[model samples]
Target: MLVLSLAIWAVKAQGGTFNYTQPDIDSGKALQDLSRIAKENALKRLSSSSSGCTADNVYFLLFHRVYIWIFEEKLRTTSMGGNGEKVNGSQGMLPGGTGGGCIKEGPFSNYTVNLGPLTARDPLAHNPRCLKRNLNTEICRASASLKNTTEVMLESPNIELFQANLQGDFRYPESRKWGFSVHGGGHFIIAGDPGSDFYFSDVAGTLTMMNRPPSRNGTLDDVLDLEPLGEAYTLGEMLDTVGGSPFCFVYE
Candidate 1:
């Protein structure tokens, strides 16, 4: 068993701020520590939060970002021997695999995700189980480069254009316009099947509602005026952006 410092498992930090940073995959121990902390916090939040932590209530990007931010802070504090200083890094994406198969590596390998089966009438009431992932390199891979992300952002000056580009048809890979399509690709790649939170359904619709800025006129200009699009971001920065946005409070 990996022997971790007692401070690593200390109570979650409250109202503290830290510089955004990515997860260090270079250290398997650090990766494992981060994943373990993430899983624990995920479960705790699911059990205690007002929304019960279901996909239906907690928006995917916002909730997961908050989850990851919490994980990042804990990991940083532990790795630095509990100094509690600002850390720099982002969440590590799951490495690519050959074909569709269970996720067998990373800190989340053995971790159990307690709140899921989005189909369950009351998913939170279900028992905890090992986190499940179906990685598919064929359809989704690390090939999504920063260039592509930048290009998409550049093309999508406003929310309407961004949404239109993102809702591309999946039949032809090349036809996946941008934004949402790429977003879906990441989800499919990371969570390939029915078990994934990204699995298409009403849950995705909920996420869309959660992500979109409220609009009265329902025009791109209005929405952009409300929340302007910015540069591409790492997973950590993305989470921070979403968590700090007005959308975070919109969920309740």
Candidate 2:
């Protein structure tokens, strides 16, 4: 809750006027408006860009993400044991989250999350709790359709446009358009408490390394520093996902 609140606060701090109160979400044109903003702004940027490329290696990631969350897990015959980083998860203090609450049985049944819900009470305090879940199919079908994913992958030419489209930035909207972020759709695949919360968002890719604009052009020398997790790498080193040190698997 604390962390999520801070995120919302940050959005407001940036002069972004979004309907943060989560209006009767079932009936709101604002979200629809946001969809248009992301599409137009992204398309405009792509057209004006000079270094845009349509190479296959540029942006091929599509429904593979959905497959990972849904099918990949199903393919795992063994139980997901405690082998990765451990943390205690918590709820967003929602008034009885629809669908369900803390997971009772499963690999994460014994799992606990700490240091989250970053709020005014204790920004980084170690508040441990169980994980909560709420799968939402409505959002997945409406916003994260194949059409949106295709647009985001093929329509966007520059990194900025891709970023905007992938985020569905509604901070600036005009009329209407049919579009939404595949990234946002993935997040909503498990929407309810923490799932819907704006805790974190990130991505990767090869042709996506270049940040081209009128002012400057991004180069492979640029550094990607994921401090606290691992050493940084140059933009060039991250090009290959299968034949590299940091990564060793190819998308099937």
Candidate 2 TM-score over all chains jointly: 0.44
lDDT of 1 by residue, 24-84 (tens): 3344455345434544454465554433332223233333444444546567655412111
Worst 10 residues of 2 by lDDT: 204-213
Deviation in Å, model 1, residue 170 alpha carbon: 9.3
Tens-digit lDDT string for candidate 2 (143-249): 67776667666766776666667767665241024344676667655653352223332221111323222124446654443333244455565666667535555
User: Candidate 2 regions off by >4 Å?
Assistant: 1-99, 113-129, 171-180, 195-218, 223-233, 241-252
Error of 2 at 51 (Å): 27
Number of backbone collisions per candidate, in order?
8, 12
lDDT of 1: 0.40
